[model samples]
Every structure is written in C-alpha cells, then in structure tokens.
Target: MATDPNGTTQSDDAIDPVEEENVSGRASFTASLLTQGRHRFYTLSMPSDVLANTCVVEPRNEDPEEGFQRALDEKRARDIANYIDAGMGTIPTSIVLSAQPAANLQYKRTNRTLSFELNQRAFLILDGQHRVFGFRLAKTSLRVPVVIYNGLNRMEEARLFMDINTKQRPVPNELILDIKRLADTESDAEALMRDVFDLFDKNADSPLLGLMSASERRKGRISRVTFNGAMKAISDSFSGASAEQIYDVLSAYLICCKSGLREYSMEDLIVNPTMFKALMLIFPTIAERVNDRHPSSFTVAHFDEIVSPMFQRSKRAELSNPGKSPSLLVDSFRKALRSGFTIGGGNAV
Candidate 1:
C-alpha cells in the first residue's frame, strides 16, 4: 500500500488486466478523477451492455428478493424501458454505486479503468438501480453514466441510498405541504399553517386522521388548497402558537367533535370542504371560550367541553342532510358555534 502525503493510504492491489483498455473493437470505459468524501471514487460513462453485465445490486437479506433496494418494481422498470425503447425520454440520470474493494474491485486512476469482478455482489447501488435494471430490459446500446464510490461499507452505502432516494425523488403533491412547512422560501400565513395541516393529516388522534392522501394508491378526502384556505382564515389564532400548541388544541376539539357525532359518518363530516371552512371560521371563538373558562389551566378536556354543545347543533349541516342548502350549511355551522361558544361569526361560503 502507498500512503499519500495527507496520510491517506491508497489501495495498492495488483493491477488486473481488466484495467487495460480494449483495442480489439470491444466495449471499454474510462474514469475521471472525482472529489473524495469518506473514500476515493471516480465517475465514468459505460454502455448499457457493459452495465447490465458488470453492475450488481447488494441486497441486505434474502427474504424479499429486492429488500435492500426498493422491491424491483418491474412494472415501473418496464414502463421506463419502454420509454427508452421508444426514444421518448432520455435517461440522463447517473447510476450511483458503492463498491467493496475486498469484493474483487480495483480503482486504477493511472489506467483510468475501474476493474471489478462481474457479479451481483460486487457493488451496492446507492441510487438509480431501477434505471440501470430498466436499461438492461431495454436491451439498447445507450450509454449509462455512473459515479462509483470505492471501499464503502454497508452502513455508509445504506446512508447514501436513503439520501439519494428521499432527496432526489419528485415531491408528491400531498407532501409538498410538508416540504414547504420546513422550507424558508415562503413564510406567508398559508405556508405557516402547513405546519398545522401536517398535524391534522398525520397525527393519529386527529379528526382529520388518514384524511389526506400522499400517494397514487389512496386519494385524500379534502383538497390541500381548500384545507390551506381554511387554516389561513384562522391563521391569526396560530400567530404566537407553536406547532405543538396548535396541534394539541385543534386536535382536542376536532377529535371530540368527531366522536360526538357518532350518528353521522366521520367521512360525511370531514369530506366536505365547506363544512371544514365553516368550522375554521368558528375555531378562534371556541379557543377563546375554553381559555376564558380555564384561564391558567387550560387543557384538552376544556376544549372538548366547549365542542360538546356544537356537536348536536352541527348535525343539520351534514352532507347527508337533504334540506341543507349551501347557505343553510354555513348558517347551521355558525349556529352550532354560537350555541356552545360566543363567537363573532360571518358567512364562510
């Protein structure tokens, strides 16, 4: 082994003949020096034929065939492959790799060829494994771009895998609210209420629990835009409140309201955007009433206490109520709020 001037020991394994470029009109790849993080690595461009024959996926276990990476989602892979075959979209994404030197690999910068034994265990795919596999299915001679990390252990490879998959994947529309909540790009009232929106969507005990859809498989009951608008109407209540405080107080009242209306389906009450908006119009008043009743020791129970009377009053506003027109719907919710808590209310339609 040879030590660099910086005390970093470079791999001094025997130079395999694979490091030599092919002059026999056969396929070959060359590497360029790339920045090193925990270990040295190189970037290269290889033909799809070479990638299919040489690249390997290091799986964590044998129970699920593709457990280490996402399950081989063949349908998705086939779709991408078909797209490639049709020459519709160019696959410009690079395949990220982590190779264990002990697993028969050598990074020879002097020769510019990344030498490795061709097998399924030679490397762990940190990213773009699906794309690589899809290219294999495409059976085309397209070039595959790659970034290979040398001598990465399993943990380091896993971390890189997670970072790439989570950060690089397109943000689902349902989850745009979450990313925006943490992002500093927009600090307006609507953006800030996304913090509360996340709570209602994710928290288990929330009335809005499991109500927001974040994936193609399941659709959320209410639209995010409508929900954000409702929250914005009551944004002043959240002015000095932390995410936890906003979640706790709102969750308490909403959960109680959900439970109180046992006769009506929770679905019926929550699926309607207008009803949700009307309640938001009245939420500030509910909070004030509870705070006034228990000035120092305000608790979830107090919020629940205030929401109890509104339950019976709001029943007429249910989507199932035949005689309930849109105007009457808003009026019923206002009456419901006034029955239990004193609120300066107005039309929410």
Candidate 2:
C-alpha cells in the first residue's frame, strides 16, 4: 500500500500489470528527496536495465492533451550505445522522469528510500529518451543518475519538457573548434589552418592583421570558419610548404594585389571572405607562373612581376561584384587572369 501526494491510497495489487512479463516487476531504491517551490521530487541512481523496463517514452501526440516527447532517433541511440560499449564514455547528467498518481509512489524519509509500482507505464520520461534507449542496448549494467517527479499530469509534463528542450543553450561550433584546438584533438590540417590564421591575425607585417574574427561575427571582419574553409582549399596545393612559408606566400600575394589592383579597394577584395576564397582558388595557377619564372623565389618582387599584369588589366566591372558567390567569382577572376596574362609559355600582357 502507498499514498500519493493527493492523499489517495492504493495497494500493490491495484497496479495493472503490463503485457510484457519482463517489465512487470516493482522498483525500490534509496533516494534523496528534494523540493523546488511547491514541487517535490526524488533523486536516485537507477540501474540501466531497471530504467529501461520501468520507463516509457510517449512521442508528441496529435491531441494536445497527451505525449510531450519527440520521436526516438534510433541512429543517435545506436551511436550512444556504441560509445557506451567502447567503455570510455560516460553520461553524468540525470534523466528526468514523472510518475503518474496511479503509480502509487511512496517516499519513506526515515530510510531515504522511494518505492513505486512498475505498471505498464509507470513513468513518463521527460528527457533523455535516447540515452535510456542506449542503456537498453548496452550489455554492461550502468547505474544512471535519475530524477523522479511524482504525480505530474500530461500538461505539467509537456511544460517541463519544453522548458528543458527550449531553455537550454547548445554550445557554439566555433567554441567547439577552439576547444579542440586547445585540447590538441583537432586534425593536423585544422591545426595548421588555425595556426596560420593566428599568425595572419597577430603578425604586424601580415596584410590580414586585425581582420580575423575567431568566434563572434564582427562588422568588416572575416570569420574564422570562412578563413579555415579557404585554407582547407589551399592546404593540398601548398602540401609540403611550412606554415611560415605559406604565410610568406599569402603575405606577398596580398601586397601585390593591394599595390597593383587599383580598380578595387583591398577592403572589398581581400577582407571579404567570398572574394578572398576566389583569390585563393586562383592561387595555384598564379603560383605556377611565378614558380616557372623564379623557381627559388616566392618574395613580393617575384609575385608582383607575375601577378601585377593580371591585376592591372582586370576590369572593374568583372571583379567588382563579389556577391555573386565564390564559384562565380572564381570564374570571373579566371577569365580576367587569362585575358591579362597568357597561359603556358606566353609572356604577361
């Protein structure tokens, strides 16, 4: 026998048995009682098997009166299960659940033990359905921290569900990348790109000084994501080149564009991500010409001799519209470069 918060009493046999025999057993565990405002709940460590058997997930129902959870993402559950099986993963966060009045939940504060009947639908999972499903799939028994709220109606359950899902802010992608870089967990190419971006942003002599935004977007600055994306495109082209060597080449190239490309300002052409990516797209072709002329030199004087003709002869109308997207801008730049400087063995116009 147990008394609910509403002063209703029910015997053990009053609980309706679920159709499945494996999930029909009752659950008893030591838990700490906690209160917030007028609401009271219990916290305990429940075995993964017991949690899977006793709890139910009701997906969002067509009727506003029922179900509050989203449908199970089976792939996400499987991924979590794999991570658990790998034996290195942990889920420290507590799963939130609500017991209906019919569950006959009783808390004995003397022993700090909470007991409840495990009927067909004893508990409604407010959150962590995917994790519970993962626990079900895992072979190793894990004791998951759980918070159980007693006698919550469908409406109350739905409100709590929304509060948890909507109110919490997810971590930003830029912060994740920065954390990975600090932890030394990012890929080799990503590390290289970040290092180069830092050098460009901090180096006084670099053309891109004070022009990179590492996290938040700023007016008149290129974002770290855009810079990293552009660098990824050129990583293969500059495969064997050291970070310093790549920095020098980029520095020399930008200086030439700034000095010779009198048609457009550097702010529109170089500081803009789309135009910068387009410029990088044509870098290998220009570098090939520079290499052909001066095999041992990648200095500003050498890059200028090869690239200045293309910059001077390029039409303002062709290069002015950077909003046409990177691929379109690449085509426009390629056309301008070809018209200004002949390919293969031909001299610059």
Candidate 3:
C-alpha cells in the first residue's frame, strides 16, 4: 500500500496504460483505447485477485424493481466458480466500471502510473457484477478483462450500461424464430389457441390427452404445429368463451364421440391432421344445437345423438381407404348435419 499526500492508502500495483487518448479532459486512467458504436472507452486486463481487491459494485438504477444490474447472486456466482473448476473453457466477458470525478484519480502519461487517493468503494461496477463475485468465490489468480469509463456521473453510467446491454447485445435470430413458433404473441386469438392446445396436452380427463403433439410422442399422434393450426382454423367459433371453457367443450365432445364407438383408438383419429381439421370445422354447428337442448348438460348420449346420423350418412367405412380425401368425409358430415339428425325424441330441426 502506498500513502498519497492526502494520507489515503492505495494499491501499490495500481497500473497506468502505455497508451491513452484524452477525451473531454477527463481521461485520467492509462488504458488501451477502444471504440464501440460512437462511445470510446478504456480496456484493461487485470488478475482476478487484483480486481477483487481494487473494485466494488454499486447497484444503481432509475427503477429499483426493473433495474439492469442486480445484487450479487451468490448461487449464480458459485455455479460459475464450479464451472471454472471443471476445466470447461468459460470465457470471461468484459466488466464495465465507472468512477466519479470526486475520486481525484490521475494518470501520468510519461511513466504510465496511476496516482489515486481513494479506497475500493470509490469505484462503481456498471456491469458484470456476477463475474467479479464468481472470481471471488473461485479464489483463482486468473486474468480478467474490464472496460472503464472515467469521471462519469450516475446518469451517464446508467445510460452507458443500458446501451451496452440493449443496443449492442442483440438477441439471436434463431432464438426469435423459435419463440415465434412456440409462443407466438401476434394476436389474442393466437395466444388463446396456444392455451387451448396446452389444455388438451395437460388435462388428464381430456380424450386427446397425451395424444396431442405437445406431449411426448409415446402415444401422441398429432403434431403440435398441426393441432395449433386446427385450433386457429376454428378460433372464431368459440367467441366470448374462456380458454378453459373452450377446452371443456372440446374435451366433452371428443369423449362423447369416442364413447359411441364400440372399438376405436384415440391415437387413430389424432394421427390424421385432416380428420382433426374436419372436426374443427364441424364442431361449432353441432355444439350449438346440442347446447340448445342439453343447456350445458353435455353428455356421451348427446354426442351420440349428434354424431350418429353424420356417421351413418358419411359411410365412414369409406374412410378406411387411404386413397379417399378427408374432404369427402367432411362434406358428407356437413350434409347430414344440414339434413338434421333425430335426438331420440324427434327431429333436431
């Protein structure tokens, strides 16, 4: 430790850069000059142990709840330390630092030595707090990279941090595309459709459970993409209904349809996307007529009544032919529903 004229002790190993470009007369640190976008800053490579001793993290932001930098996460730090110990090549990105003008730090260009009269707390970490914490946890003497912005006020430091995070580090294109397919937030209808698809995937009572493409393919015959498309194709059919309500109605209908069959596999119906799409197109009309008589009392019998005539007219035996298009079954079912089916008591018309 070296004592300055003001009686403040500083690190004896404090370094000064061999080259520095003066900027606005506040560049008092010797460092290699680097430019990013329009901002020029100083870069330094220092030992991890030295940085642990010389720097301190000061958490600052306009909104504490939604701040850019957070408190040192010890769990994350320990994980990083363990990662380093495993001999896995972990690249240490640049840590950002800032110092206020009140610190009275000076750099002598000739000898390339920094003369400072302040303690470690005089410095602020604008970014990479977790990395420094990790180094402390590791207790390793590894070299770390850092970027310094001298004589910056709190506002300037925060702005620079925001710029470095939001403006420079863009999200990868592949990630955006993946997110688009997974959780598309284009419209309310798309969001609701995803929720309904998830309902089919997760609900144990659902006939389509474990058969939708969202679940593991052990018995899941439907592809997630195809199921989502089917749901979107008929999204407007369930206007004003909540996601759970839509799921319940669909689940009830499928259960009824399956119960009426003497012997049929849910997997068989799910495997064909065309069959699912045809169901989507036909469900709305059937649901309206059944709900009128049953009035929220949906049952397997009601499903039988609605589906029996349609099945009989469609000559579903023809469905076994691989050469037949699904539209044939769809058209026949639509015609049967229009011609009206008997509900055991009388004609549904």
Q: Name the top TM-score candidate.
A: 2
Better of 1 and 3 by TM-score: 1
TM-score of decoy 1:
0.44
TM-score per model over all chains: 0.44, 0.72, 0.43
Candidate 1 local lDDT, 69-150, one digit each (tens):
7567788878878888887568877888876553366555666666665555656677876787788799566766778887
* Sort order, TM-score high to low: 2, 1, 3
Better of 1 and 3 by lDDT: 1
* lDDT, candidate 2, 126-234, per-residue tens: 9899999998888877778899998777778888899889999887666666678777689988888877888888899988787877775666787777788888887
Q: What local lDDT does model 1 show for residue 127?
A: 81
lDDT of each: 0.65, 0.77, 0.63
- Candidate 1 vs. truth: CA RMSD? 14.4
Looking at model 3, report the run of 10 residues with the lowest lDDT sum.
18-27
